[model samples]
Target chain A: MTDKDFTFTIDGASVTAQPGQTIMEAADAAGIYIPRLCDHEGLRHQGSCRVCTVKAAGRSVAACTQPAAPGLVVESETPHIQAMRKSLVEMLFHEGNHICPVCEASGNCELQAMAYRLGMVEPTKLPYLEPTRPVDASHPGIALDTNRCISCGRCIRASEDVDHKGVFGYCGRGIHRRITVNGEDLAHTDAAVSDHAISGGVCPVGCIIVKRVGFRLPIGARAFDRQIIGEAIEEKRR
Target chain B: MTAPRKARVATVSLAGCFGCHMALLDIDLRLVELLKHVEFDRSPLNDLKHFTQRCDIGIIEGGCCNEENVHVLQDFRRNCDVLIALGQCAITGGLPAMRNAIMHSDDPLRECLEEAYVLSPYVENATHVIPNDPALPLLLDKVYPCSAVVKIDHQIPGCAPSGDIIYETLVQLLAGKFEGFDPHIVHFD
Candidate 1:
């Protein structure tokens, strides 16, 4: 618990970090991937999805948001943590219409990759809730399918923070909450229709998709198809 | 005094493109090797219209979109010890189940019928009349995934699952090794 050395042991591996860095940041720097869905490196951490929950100092905290302290013992990838992450993924599936077969983001989706990483081949024990959310295809380049949205707020963060467009925002509350555009639909929003836009490629699932380019990358060639997400991230680190 | 044991497998396609069955055939020379361990019962592969006896495994390749599909799926559940939902159609209501997207609207079946038979540009003047014969199996309001209708013991997911995947899954099932299936063998698309 001493603040002298800027280092912490994560899953027994000592990872050094800066003072203000989060557990997730240190893990990323050391190539120790904490499985995450909502917390993308390019965007600010929403701490919405608790997929990156890890035991730190005997308390379960989201690694993406929890600051790393010296001598902090962080335990991730334990059977309990793995099970918790799996259940969270299951909860996401239950909440949304994530028919992975039909979803355009099946192969490349972070959620799907996470599920694969956790060895979730079958559907979760939770009852599937087939919510009939509207698919806004008014935009020429993008389609917003609310059914597959996991409410990670990545699009909300990317739109407002990164793109600085403020086109996307959260609507409703709890289970009824969803990502919404400021105007009539995506067509009327200030979305620039580029990869940099929040609604463009920031979506973890098949929620906000660029129209016509869904299957362009092909199945086997996609990011998660050839290598697991962690391997890809670690490769980037190397 | 002893009997030879072989796994009996029955397969059917409901509201699907039959691509899954094609994937099965894509096993090619391995089909001969597979036949050594398993035998086909009522399946398009065997050209059997109905099940003659109880089966060890039932491979369903489509979602239940009509009354006939329901009847057949129920029959599979009754006759088979293990029912495996194969492909996207069987597991998650593939392309055909896109019709269920209209579930939000009232009289979605009617809307779907009109859109398909009458309103679609593909339909011509003479052929535009909606088929409502008593002989035809009635279409369900929404296409249901196989798991929604019956207990699916194992699911092989894909638009049309790769032959290698099907072969691997079948081999695993045949070997009584249910757990630890290769993740690469089950891509969604």
Candidate 2:
């Protein structure tokens, strides 16, 4: 191992990482699953959703953005950190009209899976925003329903960075902030079903959906139903 | 030692589709076993309209969409020792809460009524008059989860939580062993 590769402890487990690698990247390499949303593999880390918040060096930080340091002690899976993550996930649920039962992304949704993993039975602590976001069903093969959008900007990043289409963008501020297409509707934009943003499993929720392919996987057979979120990452250790 | 008194259980459906009630029945033959521990007090299962006595447990299947639903839920809270919100409707207002998004308008209830009864081509209202009968229960400004109206001791979140979940919850609650549901079995859909 190079001199630049140093050791860090995540939840008391020793992990090795290169100098420039973020905590999330290093943790993944060590098969330590740091719960996160909006921080997809190969995509630029946004750290918008703080589901991966952890205590590093006695301070709370988003693991996805925080660079790993030698001898750094990171606390994850602790009650306080998990509680914070649960609250963040709950707030995301409250902020959006995420009707999981009717959502196309029901069982396959990362947000829903995270909620399940975090033991958030319901988002009862916060009032539902119930924002009347627009639904763009103009595209024959794709649909954009902003009601379920968590403002993670994954679609925005995937479209711009990967597809080179720049099909998605953001508008407004704070609670009013929402994802917007290039034009009036999704069809007006150059978004395609074949685009990496649509087909690449970028969206954590049902905001962006492949129309007609919904419910293709039966209830108990769907992604999260079969396995918990981050289980695959944790399985990497074996 | 005397045998423990069977828990007096009551159930009600307010602004829900009664699918939860159907799911409760979907427990199939296990219900016969469930009956061995709990006795129905004021439930549709036995067509009991009013509580004969204070109930040990109450299971509510929907959110409050109207004044009457709130009244019924409040009555349930008063008459039962423990209250459980039994479905997505009771927990998060579910499908009916879809109307809550339209509450941005000045008269959202009226707008919703007009769209449904007066404007929609699917319905044939001869005079295009919105229903305003005094006998009809007044719709609330917005649908509210059960916790917003009355204290909910516990919740089972699903469109209709599977029969197994309902059965397990009921059995555990009856045995006083319900810590919480296993996360794997607790699904939103």
Candidate 3:
């Protein structure tokens, strides 16, 4: 109960977190993986995805934005939370065409990996949306397949926060919400697709892919194919 | 007294590549052991044309892309007590459903037929001819998952779900424990 540090229970395990630290941060520090999409290590807490929703004191809260306090009890591994997460993932899948078999990011995609982590072998009983957003291959180094975007805001946030170039933005709302490039198209934007740009790699799905390297890896040697997304992140923490 | 009856399993491939069946065969030596408790009633393995009797379980290997696929799927549902959709094709429409994106067009199926069969570069001179045989099953406007056509009791997901997944699913089906299938064994290509 110190001023600088406090302990909270997540899934019945006591986890120590620093003052002002969010549950996601503390959980990551404690080697507990919380599924998220819009959240990144360096970005501000947007709390938009809600995939990290957890039960804190019996109320549902987005763990990525919820501050961890002393004696706070958080429930993450419960069937309800997992089902919600699965439904959210399923909603994302239904909203877009996440055909993993032909996707460039099939093995390395976070959305696919998250669905695997949550035990969603088949999509939840939602009918597929099957929206037909065109693929933008205008950028020489990068490609945008709007059909795969889940509206996680990762690229938008990364572009603004890390790249210092607000090249990406979200347009529309609800079912029509989509990622836009400078309110126009990628080719018209000043976004210089570079290897060092965080925007190039921040997308959790195959929506934004760097060209020329689509199928570089062999069938069984891709990122998530070797280790589940959680294990990879957990190993880094260890 | 007579011994207990063996479980009857039927498997079918709709609009999929026969890869899922190959993966099922990948069980290899385990197939012999599995045969002890189950018998194939209408699977490609046994070459049975239709269900002679009611089946305990049915494994569907693809999505519905044409009218015949829908009919076959409905027949499986009617004949089997439990139906398991196997492979990405059966579960998520897989690669065949890529055409589903363009289904809003005027006669998307005809357009696809024209593109692939009539105007394809592989063919010599463009025939500009589309098959319109009455015997052929009419193509659906869009490729649909097995569930879209009929109730799928269970699903095993993968491009061609790995042999391990098929084995585990079979084991679960034989034990009559279908709920809470193991996620570790499920994957997508």
User: Which is superior by DockQ, 2 or 3?
Assistant: 3
The two-chain DockQ for each candidate, comma-separated, is: 0.41, 0.52, 0.55
Identify the candidate with maximal TM-score: 2
For each candidate in turn, the TM-score is 0.90, 0.95, 0.94
Pull out the clashing pairs in model 3: none
| Consecutive 10-residue window with the lowest summed lDDT within model 2 chain A | A122-131
lDDT of 1 by residue, B18-64 (tens): 89998898788999999889988999987999999999999998988
- Chain B only, TM-score of each candidate: 0.92, 0.94, 0.92
- Candidate 1 local lDDT, A156-177, one digit each (tens): 8888888788888888998788
Q: Say which candidate scores most in DockQ.
A: 3
Proportion of true inter-chain contacts also present in candidate 1: 0.31
| Model 3, span B48-137: residue lDDT tens | 888899999999998999999999999999999999999999998989998878634556667677777777778554446677779988
**Per-residue lDDT value at B181 in model 2:** 77
Supply the DockQ value of model 3.
0.55
| Interface C-alpha root-mean-square deviation of candidate 2 | 2.5
Number of backbone collisions per candidate: 0, 0, 0
